[model samples]
Target: MELLNDMALFVEVVKAKGFRGASEATGVPNSTLSRRISALEKAIGLRLLHRTTRKVELTEAGQIYFERCKRIVDEARLAHEQLGEMLAQPSGVLRVSLPVDFAVIYMAPLIAEFAERYPGIGFDFDLTPRHVDLVSEPYDIAIRMGEPESSHLIARPLASLVPRLYAAPRYLERSGEPKEPADLEQHECLNILKANTWTLHKASASIQVSTSSRFTINSVGLIRRLATLGMGIMLVPEAIVMDDLAAGRLLRVLDHWHGKPTPVYALTETRLLPAKTQRFIEFLKERLG
Candidate 1:
């Protein structure tokens, strides 16, 4: 049991890169983590890490050992979590990475409801647009707007958001309404990232329109705001602009054509997840399906 604890500590220290970082992550003193790693090295009869002032590098032996130890630690953790699931209430810190605008505008109410249902579960949310590494990061789940790039991670579909073209009344008054997809080429489009082209579907037909933009921003909220301010027309998910449309701030264009649906996924490092994480994903699917 003592050896297993030491091995887990060693793994945490290696994952964190340095004793100070490990201390901050695990809430253990740096001196204690250092001593435990030293003890682990002595017991294994090998130098596990090359320590310098700036960073700690794993020795060849340490790299090999970490590969084996990580699996054991993960299995042990999974075992404990599986047992914990048998209880009436699941309990743990549920760390999640979420897209900032989406979470605030769409998921906040659902999250609040989930919290009320599972009071035993605590949350730590990172609402950033940056992609988080599921294997290396401490996050239990990540709610992403599109398909995950990494094949190693497991992803479950939560919802598909139908997108459409929208513009403020003021902008349409100035630029005139687009009668066809080709008309978009003549208008100033507010683009998100590199999505300068939009595919619109009507009945059995689809048209791809190429557009140019003077303003290209990464944030969906900002793009919606810019559209409301009559900066230009925007192609965005209908749910994102629902409030603006209700308040007469923006109007949907091309009633006969709608943009392609954007999928939202809940990503995890492994398919075998804790009860807390599994429940959260299930809850999202239930609500969003």
Candidate 2:
């Protein structure tokens, strides 16, 4: 529709921040772009944008309308891509968020393979330890660890991670071995955070150890380094410290003990996952299995 086209043009103009830029992006002349936006303002009967020689600025109505129109334009673009890709190739910018450690350990290889398979598709990935919102954020997909407390979004299980206790072999030699969880109290236990208590499980019996730490850090990488340096015993994920355990830099404590395990999920805003998202999720799921 003409109105839809005008709406789309207006959004582009605002986002691109200049009539000339929007015109170039949409392959329309700057004069035509300006006229279309004017027409849109007339039809809507609202001043959408404040014209400035330097930069375009959106009014309050413009901001509200822009959000709605942008989503519609995005969906329209996606619809066209879906149909075109049926015969051609999948091509779009995929915005993704992932947990830092998991991406470094697991997602790197998979993402590499995905790039090889879909050369047309571009990825914008954010790797942070913090959880990201699927609804409000622009991200198309997020790979998260553990069950999300937020019940609004759709999530598919990608993998499982179990807590693992490991310490440098030298630490055990100098500090003496802790045969039971209670004995950990006698040793300088490394805490990921200075405030939180550590929970360890042996057989079916769970032990809670209050930490006495010589060093404390929030970064998991730093914690692992301290553990490898024989500073103290550390508790982390099996997936995270598998190499250390194998290389004998760190050895597992209470091999028969059970630690809390968490499930990783591929989260999205919609149940109707995009093809790129679906494929990436499948790839991670397969790799995890």
Best by lDDT: 1
- Measured by TM-score, the strongest candidate is 1
lDDT of each: 0.90, 0.82
Predicted candidate 2 versus true structure: per-residue lDDT over 58-77, tens digit per residue: 99999999999999989998
Candidate 2 RMSD computed on C-alpha atoms after optimal superposition onto the true structure:
15.9
lDDT of 1 at 109: 87
Error of 2 at 274 (Å): 1.3
Query: Between which residue pairs do clashes occur in model 2?
Result: none
lDDT per residue (tens digit) for residues 1-289 in model 1: 9998888998998999999989998999989988999999999899999999988999999999999999999999999897765653657999999999999887898999999999889999999999898889899999998756758889899999888899999999999999988999999899888777888899899988898998868888898899999989988888788789999999988888888788999999888888899889999999877
Score candidate 2 by lDDT. 0.82
